[model samples]
Target chain A: MDTASVTEQPVLAVIPDDGVRIVTVGLAVAIGVAYGILHWLNKRSSEESRVGAIIRHHWQPGAWILGILLVTLALPKYFTIVAITALSLLCFREFSRTTGVFREKTICAVATLGILLLNFAAIDNYSRLFFAGGALTVALLTVCTIPFDKPKGYIQRTALGTMGFLLFGYSLGYVSLLCNTPHSRLLILFLLVAVTLNDMLVFLFSAVGPKSWLLPHTSLGRTRIGALGALVVTTVLTCFSGMVLFDGTPLAALVPLLILGVGISVLGQLGDLLVAAIKRDVGIPETRPNSPNRGGLLERFDSLILVAPAYVHFLSLMLGPIGSDLPQRVITGGGP
Target chain B: MNDWDMQPAKDLHLTGIERSRSYVREAGLSESLIRWCWLCGLRNWFCRWNGLKIEGLENLPSEPPYVLIANHASHLDALVMASIVPRQHRDRMFALAAADVFFENPLTAAFAASVVNALPVWRKGNQQVGLKQMRERLQDEKSIYILFPEGARTRDGNLLPFKPGIGMLLAETGTPILPCYLNGTFESLPAHQKFPSRHPITVTVGQSIDSKQFQNRKAGWVELANTLKETIQEMSGKPAPEGLG
Candidate 1:
């Protein structure tokens, strides 16, 4: 609960850092069980069984993505920053491609540079630079196309560029900053597992209640059971995981832990709905429906988009400012 | 004010070689960067090493949705025109390249698609389908196409007959076509020679011809192609031989 204690990290904290060892072990075991279930589901998934059909359709790709996250987390801390940077880039790429904003190379390049600088700022523990990145990027995006002198489609392109940078570049930048914290490796794993479980649990528990649509317009699949499942599963997972991840902090308290769990699940669902709304608005079909192909990376991590920022803020609220204890601006070299 | 104004890139669903060879491919920032840098370096090389010179630059259109039709005798022709493209129009310029040659493999396909910003015209496939798609892209994207209406590169130092492919792209369209004559490219990089040799090349861009005057019919396309071919011949200061149309 004290700022000093939050900053105090053991010098020898290596990859699969003390607390993350548990998460890694859980993921390693889950990988095998997931594949086993997928193999079984593939053989027996008929139209007759709705549960089996749903599991068969999504579990393989979901497990594969989680497996990749596990591998990425088990690497050195610097690699976590690299992975986050790549995630931001890919997300921007998909967003730009989907919205026809990629044609505005000036805006896209500024956004791309902003995303890189965000990760750089986070890596150097330069909170000032990191915090300034979003506004600076939006400013650049606004003025980037002025030289072209063509005012037609100006509003559409600038708005798209601003939104894309804020979501994929700026918001996702928080994940890396979270990794720069004292117990970053564990935090990353905890957030990843919690959000993944929330999404998964919601779907799995949807078979329980009389399936009625929660937001029929935004999404056809989000049901009352799914919403309740998200609330309960994410809350419990957060409360349990917070015990270890926030071992010495106020976040480990019963009320705060439960709140963190609920916040994460709620934000996670909102993130998912945001992407669904984007796809619908952009007029792209839900391509994975009735198709055997794996879902796009955009679809897989859609929930993490919003949850990442909220989780980081939750940590900051409870454990003091992340990266505040470390020497700041290691790259730019000013702040202490 | 347009409804659903945020349409995705035309090539969003395509991947790998399919994306590279597809007619609907749109150049992204990566491709634009590659083509811009590619053209910049090539411009220097052609200007310095090949002694390239240009005239009648005034005839070049202020914007795109225009065609740059030139004689094809060497690989240097496309490379030269590609290098000479204005910086503002770099990403918008696409050359109609031979699918059998440039798009034969991944490496070449990438070069043709990104560096050259080319659209593959399969010599054997449905010409109408590809032409229709390219025309739509040219209009929708406001593209500038570098076309060699001679169809294929000539082996000897003589110009080939004008083909109807150019007509297919321009027929009934309001887009303007600029007839350009490129001299000494055949000597620099002839059909038999894979690499270009040092040679002074003079490029002459003539006045733009509005294709709105031509009908969208087959006969109109042929007449338009002939008119542009003759314009280039006159610019080249060489009359077509009795046999060559």
Candidate 2:
């Protein structure tokens, strides 16, 4: 419980160098093959090319894959935290713009400031403050309108602000929390690769496998076979990755790894569907033109948003707290 | 069932420079924050630099769902008019700026839209579509539009005859039109000048004019245009020149 003892414990000692190397090399090869295939397909096809259409549709995902890998490999934990915070801010912006929630300047301003504060708490490694920030933000948002006396859209603005803060601020803040943990690179890299692979595998299976719809209303392209196929593939992938990433931990066991694997994939898929449902409900074809092909930050990383918290908490529950033996509240000195 | 109705922003899909100049451009959190900063800067600049003074501030409508028309002479005219809007209605305010000028390029369009919250008003080629969108937005969104009925800034300081397009927006609609005449703006930053001089600028806001009785026709449009022009002229406290009548 003492901060001094925790600080002296070697957190990085748990990281297996071979596991990191395998994951990094595996990611590089996977991304390289995707780009190479895309290049070949684009060149091989004619004007009316199906591959061309597919390329046009998924260029953003390709870029995203490359970007995530680069960031994970090249950047430190601090930069990764900054990147996630940026992503959360962008997602919130897209959400606010699409939902017309941002029209409430006061609410939007407060939520933005609140999001920054949440990220600050995460960076500070103050879990207590990070957990407390959400409630404080919601309360602030609720009363932020009372002084304006513009009761007309008060409920709408407050609701939008709360939802935005919870989804983007608190939920996305989990990534930053994970970044602050011991062997964080391995854990975070696993999360990123697993989520991205889950999406790609689901799409591939849906395109090539049996054609029964998964959910006709939410995801038209997704099929039952594809969904289950992705589940199986993702579970296996997550299990392997977790085994390497977790190494000597209790999560490295077969049953626990399977549970983590299945949980990550299921939660990731649900997150994607949730965003799709939101877009449909709001009657927007896309959230924002994030790239030439797909929607904005949320669309690209929607799978990760829910998965971050679920995987993190699950890992913490099975194992002890994230970075338990590592330094506690590195910035805040573990005080009131 | 949930009674809380949620609507998405209109300009969600637009990207890059297009988002800035889009008629459907909706301000999100970052844009709103920047706009607040811009408003603060604009107010400070106007008061300290232009010696800005606004008359009949009480004549300004408390909420939106209305249009504010003014005499255009300088680039500063729009800024002067936009700066006078109260805090409650600041974010909702959209200044109708010429697309040919303000929205000709990405940078200027970004400045106009992000800083000024101005929606592009294309001067040529089937303007009705844009006006139709504006009209719909003005009514449905309960938004405020700061427009110059003259369509373009005058070469001289003289007020040009109001364009028919203003009538097109107001015809058959009960949307109130608040007429305001801007003085010393032309002297501050005329169309010919790039940088503004430290000339005093004054905005005189008159009573709001309702166009309920007017039909949405050419004849009705002419009447509405003339009425707005006369109100602006009177607000200017100037004798009508021989030919403008």
| Chain B TM-score for all candidates, comma-separated | 0.96, 0.95
Question: Residue-wise lDDT of candidate 2 within A163-202, one digit each (tens)?
Answer: 8888888888888888766667767776777777777666
- Residue B36 Cα positional deviation in candidate 1, in Å, after optimal superposition: 1.7
The sequence of per-residue lDDT tens digits that candidate 1 reaches over residues B74-139 is 888888887777899887889999999999999999878877888988888788888889999889
Q: Which ten residues in a row have the lowest lDDT in candidate 2 chain B?
A: B1-10
Candidate 1 regions with alpha-carbon error over 4 angstroms:
A3-18, A27-39, A46-72, A143-155, A207-210, A288-295, B1-4, B239-242
Which 10 consecutive residues of model 1 chain B have the lowest summed lDDT? B1-10
Judging by DockQ against the true structure, name the best candidate: 1
Screening candidate 1 with a backbone cut-off below 3 angstroms (N, C-alpha, C), the clashing residue pairs are: none
Error of 2 at A13 (Å): 3.3
Please report how far candidate 2 places residue B127 from its true position, in Å.
1.3
Model 2, stretches more than 4 Å misplaced? A1-12, A31-69, A104-107, A139-160, A284-294, A323-336, B1-4
Q: What proportion of the true contacts does each candidate reproduce?
A: 0.59, 0.64
Best by TM-score: 1
